[model samples]
Target chain A: MTDTYFVAVDWGTSGFRLWVIGRDGTVLDSTTAPLGMSRLKRNDFDRVLEESLDKLGIAQDVPAIICGMAGAAQGWCEAPYLCAPTRLDALGEGAVSVRGATRNVHILPGVKQMAPANVMRGEETQIAGLLHAEPSFAGTVCLPGTHTKWVQVKDGAIQHFETCMTGEQFAFFSQTSVLSHSMILDGWSDNAFRSAVRLATQDPVAVPRRLFSIRADMLVRDQDSATARATLSGLLIGQELMSVVHYWRDQSVTLIGAPPLCEIYLMALDVLGVGGRSLDVETTTLAGLAAAFHIQTGTVHA
Target chain B: MTDTYFVAVDWGTSGFRLWVIGRDGTVLDSTTAPLGMSRLKRNDFDRVLEESLDKLGIAQDVPAIICGMAGAAQGWCEAPYLCAPTRLDALGEGAVSVRGATRNVHILPGVKQMAPANVMRGEETQIAGLLHAEPSFAGTVCLPGTHTKWVQVKDGAIQHFETCMTGEQFAFFSQTSVLSHSMILDGWSDNAFRSAVRLATQDPVAVPRRLFSIRADMLVRDQDSATARATLSGLLIGQELMSVVHYWRDQSVTLIGAPPLCEIYLMALDVLGVGGRSLDVETTTLAGLAAAFHIQTGTVHA
Candidate 1:
């Protein structure tokens, strides 16, 4: 039997993922549940963690490292934010320990920027993993999600970052706004997307008006549902790109997220003549948690 | 009892307002209901109109003039759009007559712009009313609502117009988005609103980022809900202003809308250092509908 060294948990607002990692730096076992921080009360966190460990047959002796909204003020334990410019490797120092827990439990802190007033949880761990994988990485790192982050890193630290509600806007608009009547979920049109991207990027201020055009297109020209969805997505991504083009204009961006979203970003970047590469979200998150664990146990140099 | 010469109906997507106008151009009596064009099926439109007329004891001999969603493709009858560079007074010529009804009914057509693709139903009539009230009125006319319109009018005709989804965005965001957590309905902060308007107008591309700042402001600095609401309103209106600044940059604009919405636009224009005046939505809508009725019956001169 492989010896389980520690448990890595990425406890987000609406998701819970746990991994039993062996001493050999490999995942021995894993489990995922919908018991995210949002679903658990403060007292339920310990019981929920214990239940998951019991189901996975992990011994109580195995220490656990947690990140994401579990460290939010309303989560298991409050892990306050570390203000930028923050060193990626020093994230472990800000970890808050869960009181009265049988096994060692450490929740990672988020990163906050004061000037532009930005806050990022969970994604910081992914950034840490990104830094560990490419030790000398610099330039921009984009983590696209409900609240997408465009982070600028330099010399192993996050210099600054900006957050855009692009994903959230897309979800809300496609589900609740008038655009819902025109958007379809299953198909996509690359040409429609590129055209929208070009239009939005060329005239960012025209965003509000352009958004209405999707409906007009449907009314006047009988636009298809798939093309409408792609156009909507492109319009949003293009507007976001316009806002952050200065951060990654000539530099190659490191996109860390789920494949479908990252693919969209890559396409949009291609249209803008910007270069970028993609990395899986889970791998980066696990690597980041492992790095923090190593720092916590004083076993490895960052 | 005073004579009710013609019925004027401003039938929107979710609201129905009717006014019985005398030959003297005075409103004899009026009633409002929730039976908007959207609420009634195609077959139910005539029945609903007849019922409302019956409730008001209106004579069957009276002709009716209808505007807004009642003329949409999915409404009682499709009143096709009149392409831009259209004369306001000529709107009566574009009115589509509804068949199989005892009384004569005319549904006014909306205006459509091809280049940047925008459509306006009901508001065009309001523009006509503005033109009727102020014959030499030129420059820009703004009708702010669920879909706000910025019209470029010259010589009593709509040269071109752009629609911004600012009001719809405000309603959706304040009620459903994450920003809802930070918003309050009752109080408002003029200072916070002005500051946000200034920021968004100066950097319109930063609209998305600025929106997230509302949440960050609440999270980091304990921002008040009223301030958050004001800031959100300011940000959206400011973005719209940025998009249509060319229409009213140095000109004194005529604003037509409900007082609350118009007042906000007025404040936003003031922040942008643009001149503008406000008119009541109902008054303008009635005037427009009356003008359409006159055109259909050839009763009044433009």
Candidate 2:
């Protein structure tokens, strides 16, 4: 009962995850619910938070630190974006307090890039986590998702970043476009993925053309569904790499996301002769929230 | 009744266009039905054909010439794809006969490219139409649509051709992807479209990056949906042009498709300083069908 020191929450758009941390930064206990920000209104947020804390058997007085879409405009309480060139350590300073909650609760801020116009809700904390682990870390970070993010970090702040719709684009074409009619939804091929990435790296701008080739291969050349599916993934990721290949090709790269998706990115980077490594999102998010919790609520334990 | 020389039908995936031609290759009557190949089972095709012919008040003895998806493997009767370098004039030579029908019905063959694997069901007829108008027409033609096609025509044969799923890709991203949430479905911006096309041509592989910008622009830059929609179109078309720009850069390109779609292609082509002209798809389809009727079933009138 005394092991729990603080509560950490990663409340995303579709999923909610909470962890009870000890005084020395260990996970004492954890729980998860499908109650993401998307499922709750302003009024329901307090109830969900209280229920989550109670379900974990944590003391009501234990302060909570939250990140992700829970800080979005449509979330519990908008933690307005902290514009980029934002110091990773200073994220705690921008945390917005939940109104009328029994315990002290803070939602971390997102970062918005004004030029080229991009935004990230939960990733800023992950960036903080990276810095917490390697305060001197300097390089580019790639986060793969439906809207994949490519961020540049140097010194102690997020200097710049760009978002690519490659993942979503791949999904739409594979599942909803005319190409869907010619594909086997469950089949895949690694060779096809590698070959496509190589082709995309060579002609970068021609990925869209190769997309039609996927359909044509089935219609004319007897290419199987396995090859088609992999080729689709490779073409999209390859196209994305081309935009930043010049910058990332010569630098050390860190990919932080789910391992399966990150592996594909690493494989693609290898095709371009670029080097990179990955960190799991769960570790980073927890580290990030803990950092913010300590900075903003240092007296909670005292 | 005397003006009815032969019946010509353009049966597509979702559209059925029929034209009744005169002895001198003028349209005597025409009709269209919503019953395209996609909406019917194989057994329903002959009935649709009979009903369509009867609806047009044409005698069964008049005979009928058909093109497009009606010749697809899934359509009425499979008129197998005529592998490429097959003479466009020989499209009629490859037509397959339908058995036990009241009239002598023939379905024209589509063109298929083996390497890079591509096939076209209806555009070959449009190419035949181009040759009928200018038998010596030698250059490239761009037909933009759900599956936009680029063909290299020389000496009345489709020397080589490539299909770009650009239109469909744009539609999916604009309407189905995460970007759709930030866009205005009905608004448009010419400048936005032109600039997007120009930028895409400048950095062909980066269109996916620009897609995220459309959403970010709305969220962070206060950009309107009008610009967002046009940029989406331009980015896709621009990427498509990048694939064929070198071969097409110095040639006299012809844009053949529905006027609205062709205009977008022509506008995109102009951005690259590539000089090209357009031909109405309807005009070309009719001319091609009449030529096929005269060559494949000349005895119908005799």
Candidate 3:
């Protein structure tokens, strides 16, 4: 039995989730808090790390691997962002250095592609987890989150990936836009989503023209909020799928994320006549951290 | 000349504009303030009026006529709303009681049409001003503002009108929507507006399809904010014009309000192949009140 411990942290904008694991990658204990990177002040990452570790009864000396925006420029530590079209081996220089931490800490770098404005911070971890989950998981692996990522997983490795701001944009439009008054705020409406997806995929070119119909249909026809939200979601996801269908069609796709978000990707795939299966890689971040920690310490357990 | 002075109060939601005129309809002194009906607390309207009148150097005894939302359910005083397809004679019941200072205050009632979900409070004054400018003007008098009004003017009367929440929707979408990041905040672009208008008018039925394309074009082609703004404006105005083109194609249109807002209307008319002249009815409320006063007092000046 090995005494070396491993930890995986999925730190998002507003929340931090950490999973404590043993040598076999079995989660021993898990904890979550609202201390996301956005709430931290300048140069306060060390204190936050201590607080997180203290809550878990984990010693500062225990090595931990972190992913997500924690390593972003706005993160607790200014971990350099890795350029996109990247791979797990080419994650470059690894996590940022922090001072005054109770234990050794390493934050994963996010990938950013300049050409198409694609980016990912946390989805890379999920992609890595999906790859780890399936050894021969070649083809495309999609991890949907606030920023949905389309990663090309080949030869047991994450070769390349792209991020779309579709999720964030959808939330903004549905909650804050004028259409907010006419959209479904709570609960999911698959019917509305399906019709919207149809509108988007069948006549992909008509997306720009059909947006006003959302308002007009509401005003003139009294369309319900659910339909409106679905219509909007369909348009955005449809457009994204349309752009990537050429690359994803006739290939295998592995979806990873929360069930609801993953369902959206499945729906999009189904609409495009693509075959795919969903893997419940809920703790992909932990898996990814396990992989990275092995590489960092060069400690392979028997 | 009679000693009685008439006051025309164009009290709207966010601001109040008043014109103190002699019985002959000459604007003696004008005043405007930010105390619109929407901002006033319960019973605070009297103070707003008193302060506004003090600025205009007008006494409380003047026979004042108030129009616009100042008489709605949330206004200074509830001037009963008039149903649409109404005649000029069916406006506010001669006078409404004012609480504060002693004055013969007459509030013009707003129009509320049932079928189309159209309602207007202050537009009657603009429509009245349009009739005053061209006594026998027929066809549609398009008054574009935060909420645009397309009133069909015929036989020296407002035959029918429809209201579209285009402007307010545009503002909401541009400032708070996902498109906000892709659009400009200000500065009018006629070229962009014209192109959008062309698209809207040429294919009113396809408006819903084009909305998403705006973002695509902006993202893929790096289009300017001006083009985005104009395209949005054009799409709305073009759709609106297409709705009422048959009603005013062969008749005359008198555009009212500020120069810039009126330009869009003029452009819409031009796109519809309709002839119309832009009229700067700077003090439309005062003129409207004068006409109403003449009709009420039976003065034969014209």
The candidate scoring highest on TM-score is 1
Give the Cα error of residue B162 in candidate 3, in Å.
Answer: 8.7
In model 1, the runs with Cα more than 4 Å from the true position are A101-103, A184-186, B184-186
Best candidate, DockQ: 2
| Better model by DockQ: candidate 2 vs candidate 3 | 2
Cα lDDT tens digits, model 1, A10-52, are 9998889999999888998999999988688999888889999
Clashing pairs in 2: none
Better of 1 and 3 by TM-score: 1
Off by over 4 Å in 2: A33-44, A47-62, A100-103, A299-302, B1-3, B100-102, B299-302
- Write candidate 2's Cα lDDT for A92-128 as tens digits: 8888898888888999999999987889988889889
Show the lowest summed lDDT stretch of 10 residues, model 1 chain B.
B293-302
lDDT, candidates in the order shown: 0.88, 0.85, 0.69
Compute the lDDT of residue A86 as modeled in candidate 2: 81
Residue-level error in angstroms, candidate 1, position B182: 2.0
Candidate 1 lDDT, tens digit per residue, B204-247?
A: 99898788888888888888998999999999988888888788
Q: How do the predictions measure up, each by TM-score?
A: 0.95, 0.93, 0.66
| Model 2 alpha-carbon miss at residue B249, Å | 0.7
Candidate 2 predicts chain B with a TM-score of 0.96
Instruction: Identify the candidate with maximal lDDT.
Output: 1
